[model samples]
Target: MSYLQKGNSMIRRTTAAKGLALAAVLSLGLTACASSDDGSGDSTEGGGGSSEPLKIGTILPVTGTLAFLGPPEIAGVGLAIDDINAAGGVLGNDVTVEWGDSGDSTDLSVASSTATDLIGKGVSVAIGAASSAVSLGVVDQFAEASVMQISPANTAADLSGYGEFFARTAPPDTVQGPAHADLIMGDGHCKVGFLVQNEAYGNGLRDYIQEALEAGGCEAVYGGNGEGHEFAPGETNFGAQVTDLLAQKPDAISIVAFEETTAIVNELVSQGWDFNGTTYFVDGNLSNYGEDFDPGTLEGVQGTLPGAQADEAFRDQLTTWYSENESGELEDFSYSAESYDATVLAALAAVKGEATDGATISQNIRAVSGAEGGTEVKTFEEGVKALEAGDEIHYVGKSGIGPLNESNDPTSAFIGIYKYGADNTYTFERQIEGKIEE
Candidate 1:
C-alpha cells in the first residue's frame, strides 16, 4: 500500500551572474558573513539565521529558462512558512528562508554557487532546483554537508537514490511517463516520435515512456536508441531535428523540450504539422504557449504534468498569497502545491523528530510521512499539536504525495492530463493515479 508496483509491482503517475566588480564585492561579503555547514543548522555562528529560528534556504529557478516557475514556487514556500509561523512556528521558533537562484541546466554553475552559499549559511533543509539536472548539480553539496535537499519538481527517475539527504515531493517520470504513453495510445496514436532535449530531464523521460509504448503494442518511430534525436542545452533551432522526425512519419509527436519549446513549436507549425491534432507536450513545454506563440498555436495540444489539478480555492488562495506576500504574479502553479508540501514536510519532520538539523530531519521524514503512522495529520498546525500531545503523525501533503518509498520518491501521486484550447493555455482534462513499484 505504500509503494506502487507493476507486473506484481505497481506504477505511479507521477540563475544568474553579475559583473566582475559586483561579483567580487558579493563573494567577499558572502564569505565574510556565511555560517558553517557543520550539521548544526545553527546560524548564531554566522549568517542567514538567528539563535532560534529554523532556516530553510531556497535554490529554485528564480532566474533562467525556468524562471516562469519561480513565482509560484517561491510563493508556495513562503505561504507554508507563514502558516507554520502562524501556528506557533517549528519547535517554538520561527522558520526563516534564504532565497537563492537556480539557473537551468544550461547553467548549473549558477545553482551550484547559490547552493554552497546556502549550505554555508547553516540551513537544516533547503528546497529547490526545479529541473532534474539543476537539482543534480547541487544535491551532492547539500548531502555532503548533511543538509536536507527537498525538491518541488525534479522528476527524473534515475535520481531516486541520489543520496540519503535528497528527497522530492515531485513524483518521478517513471510514473508520469507511462501515464503519457497510455494517454497517447488510448487516443489511438500507434506511431510516435520524440523531440526532447539532451539533458537528463528529457532523455530520461523519453526512455520511460518508450518502454511503455512498446509494451502497449505501439511503435516508437524515432525516439529509441540511435534513431532518437537530442537537442543540446540552449540549442533552440529544432528545424533539422523536426525535419528528420517528420521523415520518420510518426502519427503522434511528443515534445519534451523546455523554454526552447517555443522555437520548436514554431518550426513544427512551419513544417505543416497540425499540432492541434497529433502533438503531445510534456511538463517542460506544457505552459500557456500563447505567451510565446501566437494565439491558437498550441490549441489541440495535449500534455502531462505531474501532481493533481489544484482546485479553484487552493489556486485562488495561492494567487492571493503571492500577490500579498511575495510581490509577484502567480503565473503558473505547476509546482506550487509540491513546493508547499515539501516545505511543510520539512517543518513537520523537525517537529516530529524534535530537531531541526539536516540528518535529524532526514531520519524523521519517512516516519512523519506515513512510514509507520501514529496519527494522520494534514496541516502543520494539526501536526504540531499532535506531536505536542506525544503522538506520532503521518502527514498527507496538500499536494497528495503518498508515502515515500525506499528510494525516497513518492509511492503514489497524481498525473494530470492537460489539453490546450484556442488561447494556447491548457486545462486539466483528467487525473491519472500513479503508483511506484518496489
Candidate 2:
C-alpha cells in the first residue's frame, strides 16, 4: 500500500504552536490533560486525513471476562499518551484517544460495535481487543479502513499474517508455547493435562504446548488440540470436563481459558483434586483470585504470563496513572508493558513518517521497531530527539520485546513466570526469553 503524503502546511504551523505551549507546560513539570477529550468519545476529529490529529482508539476489555486485564492495559495506553504529550506530542499535535470496550469473545457485539465506532471516528490506530479471537472478528474492518490495529496481549499463532494493517507487540503462541512448556517440564512433570477453551487462542496455544511437551519427552495426556475434552467459550460448568481430565491422572493440569478458570478451579477443588503444586495457568486465565479462592487454596500454583516482569518504578507509575485517571488501584500488571510499547511504537512510527495516517504509520512501524538497523533508544523522548537529529532509532520499551518480524509479530519476547502465594495472588518469580522461529 502506498503511503499518504503529509497534510496542509497550515496544520503544521498550528500544531507547532500548540506543541510549543505543551512543551512549555511540561517544562514546569505539572500534570496536565494530555488527550483532546476525556478519553472516551471522539476525542479529536480526523480519520487519517491530511489535516487530522493522530487519533488513537482503544478497544480494551473494560466489561468482560478479561476485564481483569483492562485496568493495567488501559493504564499503559494512558501513561504512554501522557509521556508522549509531555515530550511535545506526536507530530507537533497532542495525540487524541478514544476508549472502547472489547467485551470477551463470548459476545461479539461489544468488539464489533466498538470497532465500527472507532473506524467511524477516523482513528489512525487502535490499541486493543486483547483477545485474539475478538481481534480476528474485527481486524478486517480496521484493515479495510487503513487503520492499524496493534494488539498488546493477543498470542494466537494464526494472527501472524491476518492482515497488512495488523501488528502486535506481544509474541505469538510459537514463543509462548515453548516457554510455558519448558517451565512445566522443568518442574519435572512427565504427564500433563490441559483444560483448554474451545477457541482459536486456546486451541492454537494448546497445539504449540503439545508440540513442545512432546519434544521435551513429556506427554500431553489430555485435551490436546481437537480433543473432545475442550470446553466451549462461556462454559461455566466444569464438573464433567474436570472429572474427565483428572481421569487421565496427569501430573500437571494447565487451564487455558479466560474467566471460566474460576469455575474450573472450583470444580477441581470440589473433586478434591490436589492442585496446589501441579496446577498451571496461561496468560488468558492467569489472574489474581484472592477473593475467589480461600487463603492458601492456590498456594504454590504456578502460571505463565507474557511480557517481561515490569520493574517496581514502572509498576508504580501504572498504578499512579490508573488511580489519577480512572477508578481503582491497579493490581494485575499482566500486559501493561506490552500495551505501553504498542502505543509508543505507533507514535514513533508517526514521527518517523512525518504523518499520522494509518498507511504511513504502517509503512514506518517496522522501521521504527528496528526491523531496519538503527540506534537503539528507550522512551519516546529519546527516540524523538534521535529522529530529530537525523538518526534512525529502535525503541526499546518496558516490554523488552524484540523488533517486529517480517510477519509483524515480535521476533523475541519475555515470558514471566509467576507463583501463587497463600493469598491467592501471584508474584513474579523469574522470566524466560524466547525467540520466535518466524
Q: Which predicted model would earn the best lDDT?
A: 2
Best candidate according to TM-score: 1
RMSD (Cα, Å) of model 1: 8.5
Which regions in candidate 1 have their CA more than 4 angstroms from the true location?
1-37, 40-51
Span of ten consecutive residues with least summed lDDT in model 1: 5-14
- How accurate locally, in lDDT, is each candidate? 0.79, 0.82
lDDT of 2 by residue, 349-383 (tens): 88887768777677778888988879899999999
lDDT of 1 by residue, 1-438 (tens): 122221221211102343223334555665422224344443211222223457888888867778888888887887788778878888778777776788799977787777766765677788987899998888887887788899998899878977879999999999988999998998899899988788889898998889899999998888564564788878878788889889999999998878888888889889999887699988877787656777888888899999888878878888987776554668788989999999998888777666677866787778777777679897999988887898878898778888877788888999999999998899889998899877
Decoy 1 TM-score against native: 0.90
Q: What are the clashing pairs of model 2?
A: 47-122
RMSD in angstroms, candidate 2?
Answer: 9.8
TM-score of each: 0.90, 0.89
> After TM-score superposition, what is the CA distance of residue 4 in candidate 2 from its true location, in Å?
32
